[model samples]
Target: MGEAYKLDCDICAYTENIFVGFGLLYMRLESIASFVQDAALKRRIEEFIGNPSTRYDAYDALYVCPVCQAIRNELFIEMESDSSQYKISYACPRCASVMQQEHIENNVPVHLSCPACEKGKLKATFYMDWD
Candidate 1:
């Protein structure tokens, strides 16, 4: 099952509703590939479909840009097939810097700094279960 969260920053009043985890629909290769808007990324993911040796994981995840302190909720996908790594890394839309995955514990994000203010921590509030 997947989960949804409302992340808020008390001091800055920054807020965002995000969904995390893979749902049943994510099991299909076509479904997963569709989530990727980049043509190159979509092609790479499609190649892994139905391959016995292909090992992959797909989920909704939170990413933070280290350079710009921007936050993004994105579909996270990683795969390894035929000794080739297919890890997905997101670039900060604002700064063009490589973004880092945010830490989550017990389905809740932890140690997250507010991307808006950069002074307050983010609080994750669970809203519901999905899939």
Candidate 2:
């Protein structure tokens, strides 16, 4: 037997329960720079950090649905009932367009919808999540 390990996410305050044994060695890796020593790992990490899926900073652009011509807000509220779910009900400050949030896999700036126009738009927004 080795030891038990725990991983904590600061943003969500979510902790992952992990058990480590001699058969399956467990290591606590920290920082992107330290994890990837090999060229391939470094490249992969760099690519992952650069990709929007791994990082939200790449998706900071505002989006507008052509069908409705409405500018959607990036700020969204998460549904407390479900940890994996979120909802965007803020009306567009510009066009007063009703906005709804939609989850698309593992990405940021979730999809937005307008009831009046029935347009599914996406934008980069911020939301507060506590666990």
Local accuracy by lDDT, each model: 0.83, 0.34
lDDT of 2 by residue, 61-128 (tens): 13344445454424222222211322224455566666443333223343444323443333322232
Candidate 2 to truth, TM? 0.22
C-alpha RMSD (angstroms) for model 1: 2.0
Q: After superposition, how far is residue 24 of candidate 1 from its true place, in Å?
A: 1.0
Write the residue-wise lDDT of candidate 1 on 2-31 in tens digits: 888888896898999888888987887688
**Number of the predicted model whose lDDT against the real structure is largest:** 1
Model 1 is weakest, by summed lDDT over 10 consecutive residues, at 103-112
TM-score of each: 0.87, 0.22
Model 2: ten consecutive residues of lowest lDDT: 20-29
lDDT of 1 at 107: 56
RMSD of 2: 18.6
